[model samples]
Target: MENTKRKIIIVGGGITGLSAAFYTKKYFDERQIPIELTVIEKSPSFGGKIRTLLREDFIIERGPESFLARKMPIMTLVKELGLEDELTATNPQARTNYIVHKGKLHKMPPGLMLGIPTQLTPFMKTGLISPLGKIRAAMDLWLPKKKGMEDESLGHFIQRRLGKEVLDRITEPLLGGIYAGDTHSLSLQATFPHFSAMEKTHRSLIVGMLANKQKPAPSIAGLPEIAQKSMFLTFRNGMTTLVDRLLKELQTEHLITEQGVQTIVQEDGGYTVHLDNGQQIQADGLIMALPTQQTAKLLPNRSSIQWLERINYVSVANIALAFDEKEFTYPLDGSGFVIPRKEGRLLTACTWSSSKWLHTAPKGKVLLRCYVGRGGAEEWVQLSDEQLITAVLQELKEIMGIEAQPIFHEVTRLERSMPQYPVKHVEELRKVRADLAIHSPGVYLCGAGYEGVGIPDCIQQGKVAAEQLAAYLEL
Candidate 1:
């Protein structure tokens, strides 16, 4: 008699890990393959950056608030998980956003898409840019495209075509906020290759964007009315609702939490996972969903995957301050505002949560979501909680004239949460994956640190990893 059951383990219970586990089991079940699957998380929670807090009538997201409606991967996953009905979109009417210039907030121009000016009237009439800056930006219409496909900095690309004013006043604040990185060192090829393609196709960023604007959007027929009309979507309850649903789909007995993987030992043509809690598990296949830095630590022979350790991360913090309706002086007229690094302010950006998402607060209540720290200047993230809150409040007072104390507040500090993509990032990652295939045959790596950093990207990476693992096991 011979043992026949195969064991597969996924380290890290974040979206990537859960997705890998779910898809792997689904694949195995469809083929009637007998295998044992386990998911382990270091934290006592499942969703790594998707936690929600419910206090009284307010629902606050501690991690990612929502996903873009256009990200079809997440949309498909939501539908497959029977959560389509739970999807909700941003408030349709509260669409205005702002950018801080010289300590004052200026409404974002109407036809600005991702910091590129598409409409002429609004760009010319807007006071956000000086006359010289506006004139420089208009030169993009006649600027020559770069000569080659060589990689460049996002800052350099924007500066070269439209000028530095647009990069500082518009793109740096809006786009830089996403990666929490300085545009000067950020890679254009790895982070936003589409911009380069846009230039190639139209010879002008503005002209390319104008063409994009004229093109009719794809048919989103049969999607929920809210999802069809909105650019972003999330569950009515919160983003963590997806995490909760994924939990129910998995085997409860195999979902291990509060324990992390210590080291991995190779034996018997398979692997042994040693847990930090002084336990061991044997597995024929493994999926490493942890960050690249953590993954490098577990591998015995790390000479090949040394690049993993080179991938860098930046720390940041988000604070949600609540106020009584009458006590809050600033009108919640817009979605929020972003502050450019040149402004030299402690606050990076602020989101009027109550206005942006109607479900975030009760009627007559206000919720303001403020962010601190950026890639170039993130030392403030290590400040004490009280000190941090005080600094944010002071800035808010000057920025929004909110001198009143918040009725309640919640602060979340994420250390090394955002990954930075350097030049030639895609090629570097490809080389590492090939090295992994040759060195660790049965192990797979998929997470934000590898391919992409968005929620949909992580989920897709997980599903792809599962497919590769199943094939490796010849299932």
Candidate 2:
């Protein structure tokens, strides 16, 4: 008798699931294994939070604008899929960012890596910190190392090392903008392992950063040379391009859209997935690539479910506005600004989209995107589109002295979009994986909920999960 082909099912057709399907097909094709792959997505289209809006030669990104080039997996996949040329770097002039301090926008001093100021001269000259604050922040060099087995919050770590001014004025707004999380609840060990290692090794975060800066950086393939200069990046077209290319390359038979998975049951030696529309499919291996809350709804009750409940999520609203270039009094030079919660601002952060990426707007137009409703700011999510636009514009006018009405406006409200990596996040993930090994055998998990949240991080996680699942099935 001829051997039957093994079947693989991937739930949630986001970047992670799509990447898994693509790699699974490639792996089986290389091995000459008879394997059937199926991808189920809840939405009518794929690219779950990633959507590109093209209107009147203006490319608007409703989701993430870009991925950091330093991360290798996404760029490598881009090259493999023949999209190397479409990649565009941010404008060199827009590299610098600003922070709101005492009702004014102040340039974030250069030589600072994610709130840890490395260069002393720039750190001392910045008005974001007071003389006392500067003294407190510099005391990190002399402060003894903190020894504790318990996980520390980002707030505690920065305040201990760099003082409250650094945390409130700089670190809070920058990190809070990115994570949509309160620094007090964010875990230092899980979210940023490098910083954790720095403390463990050099006893001072600043000292470790300066020491590491002197050493040569590692080589990252397929990434653009410009990405090596910074920690973040995005495409000129939008993040959806990456997803669209992946879907295009993978065989259509292996991909499924508009199919919502309802439940999973163990069968013979594999598993059977039941769809919401009363359809069933069996697979030898399965991967659930979704947020923790979404994953919990599909799994059986266990310790992992409890951990999922413990892992909370926050909502955010991104408002994109377009205005004429002549409307602003201040020159639009820097990347944008982040508003500290202490400043009591309506918006969290704003990005100068047109300035950040060339060709994002026509020669005479300006584009900006504001982030709102992070952590305790859930009320912003419930605001009407007009209300959201008004709030963001009002804040921009107050902060940047721009009072022009937007020529075009786009609002995207994400209810529980960003996952909170609270203290003990790593421990929780380890337990979740262990539970999967016992209950949902031959299953994998990936996405922002598990690892890093950046586009590069998610791409790397997706690729890693794909390789692991393919190897498990011998495909």
Candidate 3:
């Protein structure tokens, strides 16, 4: 009789892959099923985009700074890993955010449900919009519901309901900043499905937003100011703490870093993962915790993944500058500010890291990080590091008048890393999944490509993939 014990290999050693390995081991261990697991990562390190650096007295995040606390996956995982005590929420006092309009920093109006003004008084008072623009946006209260279930571009939906100025000014910077993609091509259903549901349920986004805002929000003790607000939490040490803890749960020997997967040849009852290192790893089941394009390369049917290759990505650079607290002429109020595309600035957004998170910087020092690049602004990131810093500093001088040179600076570029979910992205992914189901049953895809780009989303994807593959192996 054949051995019942099964072997599984997970491609990629990032958060998604790590979580998949952890859960896969946990699932089979709980069921008392003999299983062997290996995780392959081409990069030298794990965590994919979750790199952190401790320089001087600052905790500089080369990638994502935090995960949404309300997402539940990361939060739950933290508790499970016994790191619950290390969790830290965003500063409650850092509630305000700014948007640069007409080359001036304007305070974002309160009561905004993702840039759609919900409160009448603040919306009318905000200087971010012109008199006519405000009037045009007010028309959303009276406009009929958009009549279609078809996937529509986010730009068209926002402009149709709120008007062009609102789209360019508030919605573009706020929503477009999230995906770092052209709103004209971004999918509304794939990005912000809640807005679509709002139109269907309330007939008007403004009404829906107001109704939702009035509903009692979730709260946390001792952080009443931001208790009901969207909470983004991170570790006291940095985002890397999560990755380091995950490694503890997974055996070090099972993880192979700095090794690339050259090919995946499917065979009867199993699959073979060939590494660039002249080694072939065989497995009964495979989990591809990689980007859609990378996964396309390993499959036999390239035609099915034509859409995957076409899924666009944008590059962005994170520039972290450390400055003495006294260097700032003006008070660094609020968390930070975002620049509208109309402003034509190198910086898409800037986060006052020190203010947003208390542990990010030591006392008497500040760490400010800015993102420089988006879809149309891709050329900016290609600039030399010095050139990019100069441009960022110039913008800072003009906007905040900070003249003192940074004590230290770090620039990290993520080339074509952020996936752009264009119109019909969800439908295209559905077809990809269906095709894979027919052609490759043991293979699974997840990460920033399909469901979401956030850390929590990736974690959830990894866990779900493990559960699905475990059942497939009948473990």
- Model 1, 1-475: lDDT tens digits are 0247779999999999888988998888887888889999999889998889988789898888888787776877787799998888888778999999999989999999999998899999988889999999999989999898788888899999889989999999988888889888878987788899999999999999988889998776555567678988878899899999989999553989999898999888799999988899999999999998899888755655877787788888899998899988788787899999999998999989989999999988998889998888987966898998999999999888888898889999989988888777777788778887887788999998877788988999899999999998873
Give the number of colliding residue pairs in candidate 3. Answer: 0
- Candidate 1 residue 250 Cα shift, in angstroms, is 0.5
After aligning candidate 3 to the native by TM-score, how far in Å is the CA of 454 from where it should be?
0.8
Q: Each candidate's TM vs. the true structure?
A: 0.96, 0.96, 0.96
Error of 2 at 469 (Å): 1.7
Candidate 3 deviant stretches above 4 angstroms = 1-3, 218-230
Give me the overall lDDT of model 2. 0.82
lDDT per residue (tens digit) for residues 207-243 in model 2: 9999999988877655566667756666667778888
The C-alpha RMSD in Å for every predicted model, in order, reads 1.8, 1.8, 2.2
Could you tell me the TM-score of candidate 3? Answer: 0.96
What shift in Å separates residue 91 of candidate 2 from its native position after superposition?
0.5
